[model samples]
Target: MTQPLAELDDVRARLDADLDEVTEPLAASALAEASDLAREYGRDWVDADRCPRLVRGLVARATARFVRNPDGYARSRSGDESVEWAEGAAGDGGVFYTEPEIRLIRSLAGRSDIHSVEVIAWGTRQTDRTGYIPVEDGKPFPYFADESEPW
Candidate 1:
């Protein structure tokens, strides 16, 4: 059974507290390992004893991936082609790391030289066809000559 959202929040809160105090050199590495664990086991709920470890892992991986290569990762992350959330996709439910957590991780990981990492939030593409009106039904198709004008 999926754990209640409240439990997930509790885990998030604990992680936030932990990140505040993380300064050890090995913390990132250990959290990297914990990340693997969180990926496998954190979906429903992180076990209390393991919760801090897993949160650290989430922070570590998020920070590492962004810190190691900021521009390249940012470009890919913001692009429409990036892999997005989909049910039953391979390696889905591999932990939940929020933007706040990632930011905290970046600070704790000591990659202060790099100023920013851009990330585009994503979700599953809307699959329901209700939004798509059939052209064959003689519906007026909207068009704009200058596509760049919207921005």
Candidate 2:
């Protein structure tokens, strides 16, 4: 199997948590999931060893978020206190990359938003015997006065 982009140690560092039977396994699983997700988002273009630090950071951050809120809780409250999850939070108790993360992955994978194409326009001839006319500055070249046929 391919190596994970981020390691357990990476997740642990992000979470600032001590290793333990529970946290270790959870963090490891989260790291694996996050790495897999990043690879998939990159459409198999992402290399664990060759990926940028930002990619690794994304994996670590995603893993840490998953470990912290596995249930994908949007909010929690106790008595008068309340908590609300911000945008880009994990969803439905699953590991996921945020929008910005996905954009980064796409960019790294060479999927660009801007696109361009070259167009060649062969203008129609006034008649079959005439030479082919060419387009100039996006407009077809007008026929010379001598080239015009009598009405």
Candidate 3:
């Protein structure tokens, strides 16, 4: 029920073709599917109205790929001849954004695969403990010495 990110004209423009009745419907469905996917993946970070151009581009690219290969076949062979489909084309021939496109969306949405956190230990002094020894170095005057003592 949500609005499509791209229009039929956008898909047609990407395809560089004046879509016929049959292809038009297929393209329209593709646009809807692609738009929904973009909205779902970018719900956290993107305001659709604010970045219509990028969303539209993603929808168009995904829709075009789907319309071109609805069967989602990976390879076709005929008497020793074979045709290999493009990367996304082999997977259900469905509307899908490429890796780079997903990365762009994630970047726009302020998400990243790499993450970091500050680890803190309770009841311990907030100081750098790297290369520090309690008993041998005799630097601390808190807690039990046996905990830090070597066995």
Candidate 4:
């Protein structure tokens, strides 16, 4: 069953509070462990959990608060439906950052000066089989081009 809006907000707040305490740079070994743990946690909620939370966690851990790109693969192929931070994963608490984004923050934070970062992502391209329902005319997810203008 779907939860009410307020219930979802509370979960997000809790997750935010949990993440704020990380300060000192985690060692590569530690980062690896953390990444593994993240993957496990995300996998538990496959239907509407793993990938979305993975993305949001990237944003949550970042120092530079960039705006989220409001686009991603959905459960089905044909729907134009999108997910915001709040109602993504089953227990996600509304996060919308990606693994690359998190690594970007750790790099900028000079985390390497102390210890390497430990990152464990939930999903990857090498073996993604999330049962994406095909969209209209049997089209797959749209190709996303990052912003780059010819100067």
Candidate 3 TM-score over all chains jointly: 0.63
**Model 1: residues >4 Å from true position, as ranges?**
1-33, 36-91, 113-151
Give each model's clash number. Answer: 1, 0, 0, 14
lDDT of 3 by residue, 46-109 (tens): 4446654776788788898788777775788998997776564346567788778877776766
Q: What lDDT does the true structure give each of the candidates?
A: 0.39, 0.75, 0.72, 0.34
Pick by TM-score: which candidate is best? 2
Off by over 4 Å in 2: 43-47, 79-89, 116-151
lDDT of 4 at 11: 33
TM-score of candidate 4 against the unseen true structure: 0.20
Rank order by lDDT, top first? 2, 3, 1, 4
Superposed by TM-score, candidate 4 places the C-alpha of residue 54 at a distance from the truth, in angstroms, of: 20
Measured on C-alpha atoms, candidate 4 has an lDDT of: 0.34
Q: Candidate 1 at residue 5, lDDT?
A: 20
TM-score of 1: 0.21
User: What is the C-alpha RMSD, rounded to one decimal, of candidate 1?
Assistant: 20.7
Ten residues in a row with the worst lDDT in model 4? 62-71
lDDT of 2 by residue, 29-146 (tens): 7788888888877756356678877788898999898888887878889987886665554646778888888999878777777999976554542335344456664323444456
CA lDDT for candidate 1 = 0.39
